[model samples]
Target chain A: MRELLRVSAPVDLGAIDPRSTPGLPEATAGEHRKGWAREQVALLGAGLGRRQEMLYATAKAAQERPGPADRPAGRVLLVLQAMDCGGKDGTIKRVAGAMNPLGLHIRSFGPPTPEELRHDFLWRVRRALPPPGYVGIFNRSHYEDVLVARVASLVPEAVWRARYDEINDFERELTDAGVTLVKVLLHISYAEQGARLLERLDDPRKHWKYNPSDIDARARWDDYQAAYAEALSRCATDAAPWFVVPADRKWYRDWAVAHLLKETFDTLALGYPAANFDLGRERERLRAGEAGAGGTGEMNGR
Target chain B: MRELLRVSAPVDLGAIDPRSTPGLPEATAGEHRKGWAREQVALLGAGLGRRQEMLYATAKAAQERPGPADRPAGRVLLVLQAMDCGGKDGTIKRVAGAMNPLGLHIRSFGPPTPEELRHDFLWRVRRALPPPGYVGIFNRSHYEDVLVARVASLVPEAVWRARYDEINDFERELTDAGVTLVKVLLHISYAEQGARLLERLDDPRKHWKYNPSDIDARARWDDYQAAYAEALSRCATDAAPWFVVPADRKWYRDWAVAHLLKETFDTLALGYPAANFDLGRERERLRAGEAGAGGTGEMNGR
Candidate 1:
C-alpha cells in the first residue's frame, strides 16, 4: 500500500503534517509489517461482520420513524478507476455487499447518455447523488472525464485540463452538502490488470463485461498516472480526500474500503429519531368513525 | 385496501375470522366502513416511514459486518405474472434500491434468456434465487408460469396446472434453508390500470417502460385475476404469504411494502454481535499509538 502511495503521491507524502492514529502504527515496510497488517485486517474483518449485522438491525428499527428529516441524510460516495479486470467490480460487490437496501445505492457510470452530453460534464453525476439518509456508490464516476478522456485524448488537452477545477468544485459542493466523498483510485499494477483482462476474455459469461478499448487505455499507464497525480493534488480537499488503493491485493483493498466507509458512517452518529406515538388514541378514533368522516366521500383517483 | 384485498385474495378475506379483529360499531351503511378503512390506512402509512428508514440503515450497517448465521447466504427466487405497469419495475427499483450491494441482487424475468429456453419453465426462475444474507427482488417472478401462462393459454393446461404445486414445493425448500421469500400480487383495478396505460403512452421518457401487448393483456383482466386467486390460495403458506397490495395508489403500495419488509427483518433479530477484543484493550492500544503514529497518508491516484 505504501509503495503504491509513494509512486502516486510522492510530493504530498513529504509535505503533509503528521497526526496520530490509535490502531495503526507508523507506516513501515518489511515482512513483519506485512504479517502485522494481515492480522489486524483479519480482526477488522470480524468487527466488520458484527458491524454489518447491527447495520441491518438498525435500518429495520429506523424504518419505524417518520420520513425526510427524521433520519440522518448523510451519505458516502466511493469513486474508483482501473484497467479492465482490476478488481473494481469485485471490490464493490464484497465491500458494499451487506449494506441495507434502503440506505445504499450503487450507480455504474457508462458512456454518457444523450442528455448528459448536452450539458456540462458534471450534470449527469450530480443527478446520481444519493439523497440524505442514503449512501451512494459510484462504480466509475466523474473521474472518467479526466482519466479515460485524458489517456485516450477523447477530449482535447485544453478541455481536459479545465476539468480539474470543475471536478474539484463539484466535489467540494457535494461535501458541503453533507456528502462524505471518499475517493479511491484502485491502483492495479499493469501486470495484474493484464492477467485479469485475459481471464475475462476466457470466460463466456464475463465476456460482456470487457471492452477491447480498455486494452488500448492500459497501454498508456505511465501517462495516465501523471494525469492522475495532477488531478489528485489539485482536487484533494479537507472534506474529500483521495485514497490510491493498491488493487494488486484484492483482500487488502476490500478491507481498507470497508474500514474507511465504516469510519465515515460512524462519525455521522445516525440513528432512529425519538419515538412518540399514541396508537390507542388513533385506534379509538377509527372505531368511533371520527377520522376521515367529513374529509371526502371516497378516495379520488388523485 | 380491504376492497383491493377482497378482490386479490377472495378466500383469505372470507377466512379471516371476525373474532380476531374488533369490528367497528354499527354504521349507517358500507360507506362508513369504507371511510373507516381509509383512516386505518392513513395511520399505517405514518408508522411505516420510520420503519423504512431504519431497515435501510440496518442493511447499510450489515454490509460492513462479517457474515452471520441469519445473514442471507441462500439463493433468492423471484416470481411474477406478466402485466404492463403491474408494479414490477417500480417494485424492483424500490426494493433492490434499498439493499446493500453485496447481498442484494435482482433478476428481471424477461422472456426466457437463450439459455433458459432449452430448459423446463421453472428452471429459469429457480436459478435466480438469492444467496443467503442477500435480498432478491423479482420483477414479475415465476408466478407468471401459472398466472399469465394459464390465463393466455400460452402453455397447455396440464403444463400450467402442474406448476402451482411445483412452485409451492420450491418455496418450501427455500424457506427451510433460511431464504426469506416475498410474494406480492400488486392488485390494480381495471379503471386504475387503464389510466396508467394511458399515462405511459403520454410520457416520452417512459416509452421504453411500456409495451403494446399490454392492451391485449388488459382485455383479459378477469381471467388473470381468477388465475391469481387460485394460484395464491394453493401456494400461500404460513412461511410465505402473498401480500395483496392495492396498486392504484403508488404511495400506499410503497408504504405497505416498506412496512411488510420491516416486519420481516425485525423478525430476524439482527443485533450487535459480541465484541472479540475487549473495547478497553483496543481503546488502550489506539490511545497508546495516538502520539507516535497518527498521520494522514499520501493523497495518491486521481
Candidate 2:
C-alpha cells in the first residue's frame, strides 16, 4: 500500500482518481467498503498505539542515561496537506484519535502571526517538530509556503521556486536526526469539494467550519492543482516521500493514512527499554515492605 | 455522582475506602462490574466528545467576532494528582482516550527543571492552561507544591504552607477568566500501591515505568496521605472543586472521571454556533458552482 501511494516519479494530479480505492479490496456496496476500511483503521490504530509506547519508553530511557544529547531514538512526524474542506482535520481526528494523547503532539498552522512572518519560513516548523519519543502531526505545514504562496502570489515566482531544494534539505536533516517523516496529500476532486462545501453550508452544525473565503479559493481550483503538482513532483524525496491519498471517500482516506503510519512504525522495530536497575534487589525490597530501609528523615520534623 | 465525589467540606482521607464503588451498580462478579463500567465510560466519553466539539465551535465563532479579548467561551482543565501507582496515566489513557485529539491538550509535569524551579510554582501551570474551547489535562499539577514539597520538605514549611491560598487565588482567577477546572485525585490504598509496584517488578514489559525511588516514596505513604488530606481540604473550592475517585478499580475510576467531565460540560449547555454569514447566499453560490464569482486573477500571470 505504501509503495502504491508513494510518489517516486513526477506527479500529475489530474491523472489520479480521487474517488478510487487502489489497494483495498473492492466491495460491491458502499456500506461494505466503509465498514471494512473503518475496521482496518481501528486495527492499525491499536498497533500504532503499542509501537508509540515503545518509542516513548526508549526516549525516556535515553534521557535518563548519561549519553550524547544527539543519540538516535525514534521520533515520527506525520504531515497532512490539503485544500480547504479537504478532510485534513477529519483525518487527524480519526488517525491521531487512535493513539494516546501523551505520545502525540498536534499543531495546526493558520495564517502566520506578525512574529512568525518575521522569521524564515522554516522557523515555526522547526519549533513544532516532535521531541525524540513522540509522534508530532502538522495539520498543515511548511509546504503551505510553496503551495498557497505560489497559487496566491504571496511570494515571487523565483522565491517560491527555490523552496523545493530548501524543503528537501530540511527534510533530509530531520531524517538524519532520527525523525521519520510521512507526508500525505489528501486528494479530493473539485466536484467533491463543491459538494462538501454545500453540505457545510446546509448544516448549521458545521457552520463554524464554513468560511466565505473558501469559495474564493475554490474558484481558483485549477491554479491550486497546478501548484500542488509542481510541489509534489519537486519536493518528493527519497528520505521524505509524498503519498497522495484519494480522499473523496473519508473512510478510505483515514485507513490509508493509518496504514502508512503503521508501516513507518513497523520499520523502526521499537521495543520496551530494559530495566536499568537491579531487578532482584527491587523485587526483594517490594516483598519485604521495607519501610525504614531508605528513610532519609526528610519529612520527620514536619 | 458529581456531588458524591466533589470535595466541598473538610476532607477525611481515612473515611473514604479506596476500594469502594460509591454510586455505581454493584456486581457479584468482578468481570461483570468491569464490563458494565467500561460500557458506561464509553457512553459518557461519546457525550463528552460531542460537548467538547460544541465548546470548540463556540470559541472559534467568538474569535471571528469583534469582541473584547476576554470574552467568555468555555475552556476546561482537568488536573489529576495521585500517589505512585495510583493509575494517573491509565485514567488519562481511558478517559481522554475517548475524545478527539484535536480538542485535547495534555501536559504531564515531572520534577521541575532548574528554570521551572526558579519561577513561582504556578508559572508553568499558567503557561499550560488550555486556550479557549479546548480541554487541557494535567497529569500532575500545581498541588504538588503542597503535596510532594510539604511531605518531602523540598521547601521550607512556611513556603509550602502559604501555597494553599496562593493556589486557591490562582484557581479563582482562572474561573473568573472563563476557564473551568476539574480537579481529581485518584485515591488508591497503600496496599494497592505495593501490589501495583510488585506487578511492575514482575513484568518485564512494565520495567521501564518502575523506579527505585518509587519504593522510597512508598515508605512514607502515611505522611503523604496526611499532606494530600490537607491539600484537598484547603484547595477545594466551588469554582474549581476536587473529586477523589476511588482508583483501585481501574474501570470505575475511568468511568467516574468521564462522568464528572460530562456533568461539567452539561452545566455549560454548549450548542453549535449559528452561522454568522449569509447562509442563504452561501448555499446559492455553492449550488451554482460559481467558479468565476471571486476570481482575483492572483494566479493568472503565472
Candidate 3:
C-alpha cells in the first residue's frame, strides 16, 4: 500500500482519482465496503497501539539508564496535510485517536502567530518535533509554507519555491536524528470538497467549522493542486516519503493512514527493552517492602 | 456518583477501603463486574466525546467571532494523582483515550526540571493548562507540590503548609476564568501497590515502568497518606472539588472518572454554538461555489 501510494517519481496530481480505494477488497454494496474498511482500520490500529507502547517503553528505559547523551532513540512524526474540508481532522480522530494519549503528541498548526513569523518558518516546526520514543502528529504541518504560501501568495514566489528543498533537507536531518516521518496528503476531489462545504453550511452543528474564506481557496483550487503536486514531487525523499491517500471516502483514508503507520512502525522493529536491574533481587525487595532500593528518585516523584 | 465520591466535608482516608466499588453494580462473578464496569465506561465515554466536541466547537466559534476577551469559554482539566502503581496510566488509557485527540491536551508532570524549580511550583502547571474548548489532562499535577514535597520534606514545614491556601486560591482563580477542575486521587491499598510492583518486576515488558525509588515512596506511605488527606480536605471547594475514586479495581476507576467527566460537562450545559452567519445565505453560496463569502481567512489556509 505504501509503495502504491508513495510519490517515488514525479507525479501528476490530476491522474489520481480521489475516490479510488486502491488496495481495498471489492464489494458490491457500498455499506459493506465501508464496514470492511472500518474493521481494517481498527485491526491496524490495535497493532499501531502496541508498536507505540514499545516505542515509548524503549525511550523510557533509555532515559532511566542514562546512556550517552548525544545518541538519539527512534521516534515518529506523522504529518497530515490537506485542503479545506478535507479529512485531516477526521483522519486524526479515527487513526491517531486509537493510540494511547500518553505516548502521542498531537500539534495542529494554524496560521503563524507574531512570534512564529518573526523566526524562520521551520523554527516552530523544529520546536514541535516529537521527543525520542513517541509518535508526534502534525495536523497541517510545515508543508503549508510551500503549499498555502504558494497558492495564496502569502509569501514571495522565490521564497515559497525555495522552501521545497529546505523542507527536504530539514526532513533528512530529522531522519538522521532518529525521527521517522510519515507524511500524507489527504486527497479529496474539488467537487467532493464543494459538497462537504455545502453540507457544513447546511448543518447548524458544523457552523463552527465553516468560514467564508474556504470558498476563496476552492475558487483557486487549480492553483492549490498545482502547488501540492510540486510540493509532493519535490519534497518526496527516501527518508521522508509522501503518500497521497484517497480521502473522499473517509473510511478508506482512515484505514490507509493506519496501515501506513503500522507498516512504518514494523520497519523500526521495536520491542520491549530488557530490564536493567536485577530482576530476582528487585522482586524479593518489592515483596518484602524494602525501602531505599537501587533506583533513582525520578520515578518516585510521580 | 459525584456526590458519593466528592470530598465535601472533612474526610477520613483510612476509613475508605481501597478495593471498594462505591457506585458499581453488584455481581456474583468478579469478571461479570469487570465486564459491566467496562461497558459503562464506554457508554459514558461516548457521551463525553459528544460534550467535548460541543465544548471545543463553542470555543472555536467564540474565537472566530471575536467575543469579549476577558470572558473565557468553558474548558476542563482532569488532574490524576496516585501512589505508585495506583492505575493513573490505566485510567487515562481507558477514559481520556476514548476522546478525540485533536481537542485533548495531555501533559504528564514528572519531577521538576531546573527551570521549573526556579519558578513557583504552579508556574509550570499554569503553562500546561488546557486552552479554551479543549480537555487538558495532567497525569500527575501541581498537587505533587503538597504530596511529595510534604512527605519528603523537600521544603520547610511552613512553606509546604502555606501552599494549601495558595492552591485553593489558584484553583478558585482557574474556576473564575472558566476552567472546571475534576481532581481525583486513585485510592489503592499499600498491599495492592506492593503486589503491582512485584508483578512489574516479574514481567520484562513492564520493567520500563518500574523504578527502585518507587519502594522508597512506598515505605513512606503513611506520610504520603497524611499529605494527601490534608491536601484533599483543604482544597475541596464548590468551585473545584476533589474525588477519591476507589481505584484498586481498574474497571471501576475508569468508569468513575468517565462518569465524573460526563456529569461535569452536563452541568456546563454545553451545546453547539448557534451559527453566527446567515444559514440560508451561506448554504446557497456554498452550493453555488461562491468565492469570498462572509467569513474570515482563519478557517481557510488549512
Candidate 4:
C-alpha cells in the first residue's frame, strides 16, 4: 500500500488516473471493491486504535524520561489536501475518528481570515500542531500556499512559486521537532468533482454547500490539476512525503488513508512508558487515600 | 427537554444532581437507560443533519437577501466546559460529528500559551467563533476563567470573580452579532471523576491522559464545584443560554447535547435560498459547457 500510494517523485497529472484503486483486487467489480475496502477498514480500525494508543504512550515516555531529551517525543501530523468536493471530512471520520479522541487534534484551515492573511501562510499552521502524544489532523494545510494560491492567482506567480522550498524547509523543521508528517492529496478526476458539485446543486439539503464560484473554479480545473501536480512533485520529501490517494471511490480513499496512518504508526514502533514509581505502593496509597501516601514509599525513598 | 436542561433561572448546583437524566423515560433500569439514550441519539442524528443544512441554507439566503443587511448571517456556537475526566471529546464526536463537516468548526482550548495568557481571557475565544454559516464547537471555553482560575487561584480572587458578568456581556454581544450561543456545563460528580481518574492510572492505554497535577486539582473538588455554581448562577442568560448537562453517564450526556443542538437548529426555521439564477438555464449552461451561460437571466434578473 505504501509503495502504491506514495508519490516518491514529482507527480505527472496526465500519467496517474484518478480512477486508479491501488492495492485493491483489480478484477473485482465496483460493489465488491467497495465491500472489500470497507472490510479492510473494519480490520484496520481495531489495529489503528491499539497503534494510536502506543504512539501516544511513546510521547508520554519521552516527556517523563527524567533528563534533558535530545529528540522530541513522538507526535504525528496528517496534513490533508483535496479539491472542493474531495472527501477530507469523510476520511477524517472514517479513518482518524477510529482513534481515541483523547489524543486527537483536528484543525481545518479555511480561506484566511483578515488576521490570518496579514501573516505568512505558515503562521496559523504553526499554532495548530498537535502537542506530544497526539495526532493532529489538518483538513487543508499550508499546501494551499502553492496549490490554491497558484491556481486561483491568490498570490503572484513569484510569491506562490517561492513557497515550495519554504514548505519543504518548514516540514523538515517539524520533523526535527519530533513531529511525523504524513501528507495526503485526495486525487479525484474532473468528472468526479463535477458529479459531486451537481449533486450539491440538485439536493436542497446540500445547496448550502454549493458555491457558485466553485463552477467558476471548476472552469479552471486543468489549472488546479497542474498546480497540484507541481506541488506534489516539488514539496514531497523523505521527512514529509505526499501520497495521492485515489478518491473517486470514497471507501477506497478512506482505506488508503487508514493504511498510510497504520504504516506510519507501525514505523514509530510505539510502546507504553514503563512505570517510574512503585506501582503496588501507588495502588495501595490510592485505595487508602491521603493517610496512606507516605506509608508505602519507604523502599522508593519518597 | 429545553425546560428540563436549560438554566432558565440562576442555577443551584446542589439542587441539580449530576446523575439526573432530564426528560428521559422514567423508571428505566441502568442498561435500559443507556440503550434508550443510544436509540434516541440514532434518531436525532438524522434530524440533526437536516437542521444543520437549514442553518447553512439560512446563511446563504442572508448573503443573497437582496439588500444591505443590518445583521451578520446566522450561525451557532456551542461553548463547552467541564472538569477533568468530563466527556467533552466524546460529546463532540457524538453530537457535532453528526453534522455536515462542511459547516462545523471545532476548537479545543488547552492551557493558555504564553502569547494567549498575555491577552485578556476572551481575546483568543473571540477569534474562534464560527463564521456566519457554521456551527463552532469549543471543547473548552472561557468558562475556564471562572472555573479553573477561580478554583486554582491562578488569577487574583477579584480578577476571576469579575469575569462572570464580563462573560455574560461578551455572550450578549455575540448574540447581538447574530450567533446563537449555547453554553453547556458537563456536570459530573466528584465520585465519578475519581473513578475516571483512577481508570486513567490503571489502564496503560490511558496513562498519557492522567496528569499528576489533576490529582492536586481533584483534591480541590469542592472548591471547583463552588466555582462552577457561582459561574452558572452569574452567566446563564436568555440570549446565550446555559445547560447543565448531567454527564455522569456518557450515553446520557451525548443524547442531551445532541438534543440541545437539534432544538437550537430547529428554532432557526432555516430554509434554502431561492434560486438566485434561472435554475433551468443554469443547468443547461452547466451541461452545455459555456455556451448557455448568458441565457440564464430571465426571472431572477441575473
Any idea how many clashes model 4 has?
1
Which segments of candidate 1 are over 4 A away from where they belong? Answer: A1-72, A276-302, B1-302
Q: Give stretches of model 4 more than 4 Å off.
A: A25-30, A39-67, A96-134, A148-162, A274-285, A288-302, B8-10, B26-30, B53-67, B97-103, B109-114, B275-278, B290-302
In candidate 1, how many Å is residue B63 off?
A: 31
Model 1: lDDT to the true structure: 0.57
TM-score of chain B of 1: 0.70
Q: List the residue pairs that clash in candidate 4.
A: A10-A233
lDDT of 1 by residue, A232-291 (tens): 777766667777666666656666666676666566665433213333442343333322
Report how far residue B186 has shifted in candidate 1, in Å: 12
CA RMSD for every model?
Answer: 17.8, 4.2, 4.8, 6.4
**Candidate number with the higher TM-score (2 or 4):** 2
Instruction: Identify the superior model by lDDT, candidate 2 or candidate 3.
Output: 2
TM-score per model over all chains: 0.47, 0.94, 0.94, 0.83
Tell me the TM-score of model 4: 0.83
In candidate 4, residue A290 scores what lDDT?
39
All candidates in order of DockQ, best leading: 3, 2, 4, 1
> Tens-digit lDDT track for model 1 on B1-302?
22223223343432332112222345523545545544544454343323333333344344435576454433333333334665765654444433335445566676666788789887987676754545667767788788777887878999988987888888887788767766776666555565566565455433333454565666665677678778888777766667666565554455445546655655655442233223454334333333233332222221
Interface CA RMSD of each prediction in angstroms: 18.9, 6.5, 7.0, 10.0
- DockQ for all models: 0.06, 0.42, 0.44, 0.16
**Which stretches of model 2 miss by more than 4 angstroms?**
A26-31, A68-71, A290-302, B26-31, B68-71, B290-302
